[model samples]
Target chain A: MTETVSRCPVAHDQLPQPAPLPFVSEDPFHPPQRLGELRAEFPVSRLLYPGGEIGWLVTKYADVRALLADPVTFSSRNRQRANPIREMPEDFKEQPPKPGLFINEDPPDHGFYRKQLTGQFTVKRMKALEPRIEQIVADQLEYMAAKGPVADLVADFALPVPSLVICELLGVDYAERGSFQEWTATLLNLNSTAQQVRAAVDELDQFMLRLVKQKRAEPDDAMVSGLIEAQDGAERPLTDEEIAGIAFLLLIAGHETTANMLGLGTLTLLHHPEQLARLKADPSLVDTAVEELLRFNSIIRVGQLRVTTREVEIGGQLIPAGSSVVASNLAANRDPEKFDNPDELDITRGAVHHIAFGHGVHQCLGQQLARIEMRIGYRRLFERFPDLALAIPLADVKWRTDMAIYGLHELPVTW
Target chain B: MRVELERDRCCGAGMCVLYAPEVFDQDEEDGLVLLKIAEPPDSSLDAVRTAAGTCPNSVISIAG
Candidate 1:
């Protein structure tokens, strides 16, 4: 504590302001070059958050992993309370989301809900889903071939494939995808107005609530239905609100993150034709390629928000208790200490250790599904159209820098 | 190589299965690591090592 006080002097305000936590890059495929330097120089730096608060910005690979793994010292529960960019209005009277969202919870509660869905996302389960996913990929490619010479890959393929798959898995109607996609887009956009975000969230919740009610009355083979059935059979059944919360999380997380990955991953491959050619020549590289793509892009730019629950020492710096901390996945994935030639994207690199899906207890549950989708999606897209290339110049492509999930807004491609 | 897993510590990140599917599987109930072959052949030793190293929970260990 004495050391911590000495390092962070009483006149903190008078000291030079540290670089802001969220590093906005003009190039969405690559994070700001300064982040690498920061990771090397100041792995744990005091920084200003968008909400006008100072917090710890952790950039090094080992440090980021350490903080993420120790949820006891750094709690995800602070995400709602100490969000740098507050999403809700100060006077908004709606009750905060119940502790049912597993990602936001800590310890026993997180494990309780997460374990319930773990079996559903196992490698075997995802492997079983691979064939159906392949058909979905094939169908999308077939449609693209029929409509092409030119197409916006994001809308025509990237977004819909996952949307449809998730819809089928969740038992949500595929026809409702357009509205939900819009809602998700708005809800995740960093630049979106609070009112716009709230409206989108309300719409999504209402739809999920209806679906939960429907599932309660009549269960089916989908994940949501399975959850409902589990709830009914349990000694202490989950409330409809809890069930709806789970469904809502799955619906958005199930599609949004993967959709962005597909769009951005394709764009990244297109930028490096040599890599694309190598992948096209050897389809078996799909698995490793997906891992590399995930690592190279590391789409969730700023990583997850956490607050130190107790005084923690990281990268030789003391992060005071209750301080907001951001572990940059973008930085960690590119850590020179972790990977060789970190900036270069080599599909054959086999970067299995990367923290793209994140690390520790709250790692992405849908990761296996996302990997299979990418594997099938990339393989089928390249296989079907051997001459696939971008329809528009790389400069013209719109990057979703304003969104929480980093990716291309529209990737126009031509065969 | 003989592979071992501390099932209780498994958080189901699935890196082991992804890297060395031939040597590992996950429980259908909770996604915990399940060793398919306790002593995999020489050909799979490299993959087994990768799986052990990549596991976030460090649940997997290997010894001859």
Candidate 2:
């Protein structure tokens, strides 16, 4: 059993006015040299949501992982926007209730929605799409080469591959990926206006709703159509609204994560030419390199935030019920105790286990699909331009300076 | 060795299939490993090991 680390609960409780984010996790919030300082310094610091209200930020790997895993101890439902900064504007209430995918809901609701998605992300399903992923990567790279010498890899290739794949899976019009790309980016911006956030969610729901209607009329070889066929009962098949919720989850959760992984992952490989060479020599290294890349630079700053429903202990620290929490996936992957040389980029280091895809019940559903996409992307990109190198020094390349997604905003490269 | 699971300990994190799809499958409703192979082939031993190591919990084990 793990115990929660303690902080000034009274201080958090008394904080009527939540402070704005000084910087999002992706930025040089602190020095890259001191990436895990939040863990050692505040262990469990305070966070201000989009609203001015405060939430707890858990930094330790074990603590964050345990909190996210132990749903009985830590609750996620109705924990969306932390307690109001002052008073939530009535306008805030105008936004529709967030579609309760298993990501935010605790069981038995978590179990229910999760059940709906389980069959869809299985390895068999994902592996079937391997060739398509390879083809997608090859096509994108070909498109870039035809465009010639200097291309922004992030824009030209990395971003579109996952965007196209998710669209195809959910039965959305893949050709319209360019628009979906922008909307999704705005939604993930931590400091985006509330109206903007609400609009993004609403637009996604509408997009998904249209697909659901199309799938109902004529099924296809996609998850959306497969789901339309899955019947829970004779009369009580899932409603359109419910279908909207599930598609919304897969689309929103699946896309950027893979995009960020591919973009950031390519950057990592470029920075470490030795590792890239090792991987190119043996494509088998792609699997292990993926894990190393994930650990070296994690997915989310913290996977997801949870609130204690009852007094809970994690990693030996006890947290009071209703306290806010975040599981720091970045800190956990870098936890020296977990990896042999946690900081090293060794593609051959097969003894790796990372929480990049997360741990516990809410682990990423798109992980299998993501793995195939990344591996195929890496294989094709490296093979096509074995001389592929960053056009600019890493110091000059810009990463998203204020977002939860750690990614290169523009990965400029030339062969 | 046989791969076994403590179903109650499973939180539906699907690491098993990634490592050994031949040996593990997911429930239709939940993503928890459905134990497709009780006695995995010798060639799949490495995958089984990866599955056990990858499980967030120590829920997966190989016992003779």
Candidate 3:
């Protein structure tokens, strides 16, 4: 690499040595052990990306918050270039995100798509779905009860509860969940090859396109149908492609995140028996427990990747324009300065401040819905099966170590 | 407590509504922050502070 004089405050040679991201930890609930050390020594540590680019991993709570809050300085538009966990598809590295896939976009383009759907996910709207969510949770528990004595909770309960909720919400036929679920698993897998990811994307696109057409022909009250009928402030109604793109984004995002949280969160509680006892003893602690679980799991383990749009200082390190940065929420949530006992699972901690749903303009859109699912999902699960325990040995449980979204592959449980 | 809001900056994450529904809400059309009570009662002070502090867009501010 040439020692070129650019916007960097220091010479290229003077920059900190880049280290590969620490990927594993002995404890499933905790982030990689090295992250804590790095957060202490270098909150904005230099990182070597899988594509052989040098990036920065931001681990401090305040710095992560600041970095995400300023989306203009640290833009999401170039996320493909900054992902430290895996090499993104080369074809997509420079292309602007497909219309309606606003998570990859910066405002006002992002807000254009986001705002259209924001009303659909408002707290009030999500709260209104509580009765339906309770029914879904209850029905799933009944399904589990019938299949129990030995059940993979990931399939029998955790996955289905959110899957059914999102399916009903999006106007997708719940019967077809198997196909989308398979494709999403492949898409979110960190180890998926470029070709495999491309294939999954193509399949999902086709599926959503067909669904969008159906919704147009036979409109329903669900989100996809609502999106089709309501243009909001757009100059023209959303095109078929844009609607399909939006549906595709929501379909994958809607289920996988909350499903994983449910699976992994249940496991986390099982591991922490005392905490589980407190939650079971007092069901009212469900809200705080959900927040704490989100904090503790930090399931979006790859962190929110962004490229600096200009030279900016994060944690005192001046990152130059176009440089990649991974804001490590996993480390941020566990920052000692922010929480009294960062790693300890304390359901009463009221960890609402943790950025598990992330921070800023592009924070998780379905957060309210996810919270509702978790709160209801956990309470119902424990209430239905008070003696729930792992049917298989802890070591036998398959962790989603290969995925961008952290979760359990199969959570074998019994009452 | 007097709650100040920059509705234009509100990204509609609904943390404010979740924390203090009495003081904040999302507009029916755009889901932007809609202040229900600019000066809330003392009973809701703690919840209002949380709403201001945790709003994703930091669009909410509180003053005595």
Would you list the rank order by DockQ, best first? 3, 1, 2
Question: Which pairs, if any, clash in model 3?
Answer: none
Candidate 3 residue A25 C-alpha distance from true site, Å: 1.4
Worst 10 residues of 3 chain A by lDDT: A1-10
True contacts kept of each: 0.48, 0.40, 0.67
lDDT of 2 at A262: 87
Give the per-residue lDDT digits (tens) of candidate 1, residues B1-64: 7888888878887878988999998999888888889989999988998988777767889987
Q: Which candidate is the best by DockQ?
A: 3
Q: What is the interface RMSD of candidate 1, in Å?
A: 1.2
Off by over 4 Å in 3: A1-16, A232-234
Candidate 1 lDDT score at position A158: 95
Per-prediction TM-score of chain B? Answer: 0.95, 0.90, 0.93
Q: What is the C-alpha lDDT profile of model 3 across A347-405, one tens digit per residue?
A: 99999899999999999899999999999999999999999999999988899999989
Question: lDDT by residue for model 2 over A92-202, one digit each (tens)?
Answer: 644444564557777776766776776777777778898888888889999999985789998889888998898888888877776666777777776677678778777
Q: Is candidate 1 or candidate 3 better by TM-score?
A: 3
* Winner on lDDT (1 vs 3): 3
